[model samples]
Target chain A: MNKCHITNEIRKFRFLQSEMTQQELAEKVGVTRQTIVAIENEKYSPTLELAFKIARIFNASLEDVFTYNA
Target chain B: MYRKEKMILASLLATIAVFAVYSLYVYQHYVVPKPEIIHDFSFWGKSFLFLALVMVAAQIIVHIVFAIINKIVTKKDIPVISDEMDKIIELKSLRVSHLIFAGGTFLAIGSQAFGIQQWIMFAKLFSSGFIVTILSDITRISLYRKGL
Candidate 1:
């Protein structure tokens, strides 16, 4: 099976936003910290809703938060 | 390790221990005494019913004890809500378990067709159930560790 190559700039955005921790982002996004870690590590892809929520938390557009490469 | 991983590991251990001890007790108390009782359908039915009840009770006790000990040692609460990733992993694990169980049932039926004893068929069914459960737990732990 082909692997997903979805990547995110969540770490960069979090850093720019007062060095927000993964736990804080998780709480805001209503997910577990482990989930945020999985997303940042490219181990799991969030759903559209979760991705939008995350981008909204950083006050950024969806494209700015996540990118997918075929 | 994550609390989820710890909980799974604890459950896996409890499964093995409970199954082993229960099997030993049943063997000593019932199978060794009359041996012919193994062929009794009613005996098998009662055994399966009791085993199911014991397993459910044991799992509840194990979870409660593990949770209390974990809280005292780590001072952290276990996550109460499961996220999407957790649900996906659970579904995948259950799929594997169900597939294995189906295969086990087929093999058990095949054995009966080959003129095997009825008792062996029941044993096969029981063993398959146990194996699927253990494999499911292992699959969950592996998915958590390696990512899905």
Candidate 2:
């Protein structure tokens, strides 16, 4: 089976958005900071709802925040 | 380490400690003094029941103590709410533990089928339960560390 890898530009967007900290973003998205770290490191894939929430936080579309690699 | 990971580690340590202490107490007080008690079904039943109750109480106390120590050392409140990732990790670890426990059960039953002593069968069951507990914690810790 082929593995699906999802990557994100959360760090870049976080930097663009007044240098927001992971903890701040986590609080805004209602997840723990460790979760944010995992997502940023590509160690985990967020659900669609969470992905949308994160993109919404950055005032961007889902595509702008995340990319899918198969 | 994340707070959840630390909690898992603490739980693992607590389990080992409790099992060690309980096993020693049981051995010195019961098994050594009256080896024939091994044949008593009621004795096995009571031991299992008491061990379970003690484990639950120990876990509760460990968590409380850990929370207090964590607050003092980190000066930050531990995350009480679990997020989506936490749920996924928990489910995955649970599945692994369940499979292991099932296998253990089969082995324990097989021991009885093979005409093993009744006490050996009970010991098998107890050992399997202990192994399952330890492996579950280990699975959780690994998932938290390496991610899903």
Off by over 4 Å in 2: A1-4
Q: What digit string (tens of lDDT, one per residue) describes model 1 on residues A1-70?
A: 2365789999999999999999999999998888899889888889999999999999999999999987
Give candidate 1's total backbone clashes. Answer: 0
lDDT of 2 by residue, A1-70 (tens): 1233998999999999999999999999999999999899888899999999999999999998999987
Which CAPRI level is candidate 1? medium
Tens-digit per-residue lDDT, B9-127, candidate 2: 99999999999999999999999999999999999999999999999999999999999999999999888779999999889878988898888888888888788888888898899
- TM-scores, all candidates, are 0.95, 0.97
CA shift of A14, model 1, Å: 1.7
Can you tell me which runs of candidate 1 are displaced by over 4 Å? none
* Model 1, span B1-148: residue lDDT tens: 6788889889999889988999999999999999999989998899899989989999999989988998899897777889998998899999999999999999998998889999999999999999999999999988877776
Alpha carbon lDDT at A8, candidate 1: 96
Using DockQ as the measure, the top candidate is 2
**Considering only N, C-alpha and C atoms within 3 Å, which residue pairs clash in candidate 2?**
none
Each prediction's total of clashing residue pairs, residues at least 3 apart in sequence or on different chains, is 0, 0
